[model samples]
Structure formats: structure tokens, C-alpha cells
Target: MTTNTTPPIPMDALRTLPTPELGMLLLERLGKETRFLPQNITAEARIAFKGESDEADLLDRVCEAWAWVESKALVSQVGTKTSDFRRVTTDGRKLVADPSALVRLAAADRLAGPMHPALEGHVRTNFHLGQYEIACFAAMKEVEVAVRDTAGLGHSEIGVNLMRTAFKPHNNGAGGGPLADAGAEGGEQVAMAALFAGAIGVFKNPTSHRTVTFDDPMEAAEVIQLADLLLRLVEKAKVREIKTENE
Candidate 1:
């Protein structure tokens, strides 16, 4: 005698069940457990779905919907443990309260802190989209490194013109891609240069306390680079020799 081994029930099967059954399954899995069932297969949501179904298909379709949410990789646990995020798709109850990654990103200030260790280090190199504007600046720096590495790219500094041009390739809503604010012209270098000058000025003349200002994007980018480089230098310097603000 041969023992039969069958694959698990497919989510698409859920559709075969009447509306009452489907609704109950959804509620049962989601913990809201309702008796209503929707038999209208012509509904936009049902019509759009394409997936395998399981017994009476109610339970299966619920899984299918959750699968759609998971495919976006934008799933997150809200009003609950972050560790529970992964459990959202397994059960309906979890998804009901889980919310989307976009939601979490919007509430990032309260849901979590800046770029927790859990964020992906690859791809976007960002923890959240709405509040992680620093990542945009960081991306510019990484791009600079990449350009430098390429033999023909000239390793140009991400000045205002270059920074704005960098975004030209992408067009989002309103014919322009969404992007972080690139500080005023002369850019990061200019800003950093001024900051460094201030720090240096402080050392040179402790009596003159004029505030430093950079009005150009290119200048700001240069300043940022200098500051970063100096920070690295300070990090490497001997304990007694370190005199920077962070030191």
C-alpha cells in the first residue's frame, strides 16, 4: 500500500465558499469572527485576485489577501511587538492590527527610533521613507564614493547642480520625483567648510564668536565631507590629541 502525500490547501479555494462562509473564515482567522459572507465574485477585490484556493475556499482566500500584503515587503507590526510583525500573514487577527510598512514609516518617530539595527543595510539603505531624510544625504555621499571608484566618472562632488541633476532621472508625482531637501546652493561642502572654519576660528581666536554661514550647496557638500573626514580623523587620533567637539 502506498501512503498518499498531498500538498497543503491553496488559498484560492476560499472563493468557492458562499459569502457567509468566507466572511466567517476571515473573521475566524482574523479573530473578529463574523457571520456575513459575500457571494459577489464580481467584486473588484475578488476579481483582481489570482491565487490557489482551499476548502470551501474561505480560509484560503483570506490567506491570499494577506499574501498580497506580504509581497510588498511593507508589512509591519503596530500597536504590538515588533517581533510579532513576521506573524501578520500567518493569521488574520495579526494582520488586522499589523498595518503596512508605510504606516509604520509615517509613525516612525513614535513607533521606533532612528534607523534601528533591523533596517536593511542594502538597497535603499534606509530605515523609513518619510523621516529618514538623512539617508538621502548619506546616499549622496555613497554615490560620490561610487563615482570616484568608476574610472571615468571624475568623482565629482555632489554640488547643488549635480544633486538636483541626480534626481532628474526619476519622475514621481507632479512630474518630479519625491526627494529630501537639498540644502541651499554651494551645498553640504560649503556648510561643512564654514563649520570647520568656526571650530578652527574658535581655536585661533577665542574672543571672536561670529556665527559661520554657508549659502551655497556646493560649499555645504564640501563642508560636510570635511567634517566627516575630520570626525574619522578624530576617532583615530590619540586620546590626548583629540580636541574636536565630539572628542
Candidate 2:
């Protein structure tokens, strides 16, 4: 659904300095003895080297490196917005001196919560940049694709109608089948059908058609998790159990 396959590393910079050397420079920029002021770092990073590189491009690489280390809590921003400064933590210095002290900072978790493995390729990539709506939409598209495949439906069957057709409960007079266990009491089947169909209608459609704001990553995570739950249910769909009888 989303083609965000860009690896979060600058290859050329890594080749030139390696992660350790680059990490140490970041530490130096952040100050080993004293805190580095935000203004000074920006000014220093923008100075071009021997006319071989652009200042802005170099600044971006430097900032990208810092963001990875900062996310790992190795560097902390001091003071309020007006008077911001950065200081390398003791752990940060350890990583600077010995980059192998721990696993790579770039390889660490991007968010506080665990991202579903299913979402890693597309959905979570968008989420990494606070693009919550895009992540939610990608996640829902994943659910739609999963349901479509599970139902043996063509691309023609889409959105809510596809969901309804696939999961519509068979009341002994149906042309289609249930998407979940047609339970002994029949209520579970009915509820499952409604849940899946409703989820596609409510969660998938709006995000697919419009720009729905999901302000926070927590909110986006919850929505993506909702799709995760529904997709797991779709995985349970099978033709043999499409018409289970009450026992």
C-alpha cells in the first residue's frame, strides 16, 4: 500500500566515516566536557568542507545521525525551547568510544510500543515520521488485502461490500459464507461478521478516501492494532468451516 522501503541510513556518510567515527563526531558536537549549544552545532555543521559538499546536505546527515542517537536517549536536550542545549549522556560517551558497546542505535526501536511484524514493511514506516493517517490507511489496506485473499474474492469486490459478502452470516438461505467459526450458538458468527464488516466500513473507508487526522502515535498504534486484530481473524477463514452446524 505504501512504498516506504528507504533504509534509514546514509550509505555514503557511513562509508566515509563509519558509524563509530560518525557517532564520535556527534558526541564531540554534543560536548564531552561541556554541553553543545543548538545554535553552535547548526553553525558548525553548515560549514562546507573543501567545496566538496553542500552545507545543507552535510547538515542533514549530521542531524539524521543525531536523531538516531537522541532517540536512544544517548543525548538529551537541555533547557526550554528558547534556550535549548544538548549534552551527551555517559552511556552516549561509551557508545562513542566503543560503538560496539551495544547494538546499533539505528537498529533500536523507533517507538515505545512494539510494532506488529505484519506492519513493518509499509504501515510502520509511515508511522516512523508521525504520518499517522498514512500509517492507518496503509494498515487498513493491509486488512482489506488479507480479507480479499482469505475470501477468494477478486479485486472487483472492495471495501464494505467485499467485507459484507465474505463475512455475511449464512441463515440457511444464503448465497455467501461466514468468515469466522459459525458457532454452536450462532451468536459468535453473527458478531464476528458484524465486527469485520463494520471495521472495514468505519476504519478503512474514511482513511482511504479522506485525510483523517490521527494526531498522536498512540492513537495511530491503536488503530493499526485494530486492523491487526481484524486481519488475524481473517486468517481464520476457511471454506471447510464456512458452514459449521450447531452441536
Worst 10 residues of 1 by lDDT: 175-184
Model 2 misplacement above 4 A: 1-117, 172-178, 238-247
Model 1 has a clash total of 39
Q: Which stretches of candidate 1 lie over 4 Å from their true place?
A: 1-60, 66-125, 128-131, 149-156, 160-247
Error of 2 at 149 (Å): 0.9
Candidate 2 lands at a TM-score of 0.52
Cα-based lDDT at residue 50, candidate 1: 30
Give lDDT for model 2. 0.65
The RMSD of every model to the true structure, in order and in angstroms, is 18.0, 16.5
- Tens-digit lDDT track for model 2 on 1-247? 2223321233356447654456556665455556666556545444433133353555666666666667667877655435566777777887767655444333334344655467776787777665778888888888888888877789999998888777777665444464645443467667777887787888779977887887655666777888877876675565344534332
What is the alpha-carbon RMSD of candidate 2 to the true structure?
16.5
Cα RMSD for predicted model 1: 18.0
lDDT of 1 by residue, 83-140 (tens): 3323323334433454343233223323233322222252133423322333324433
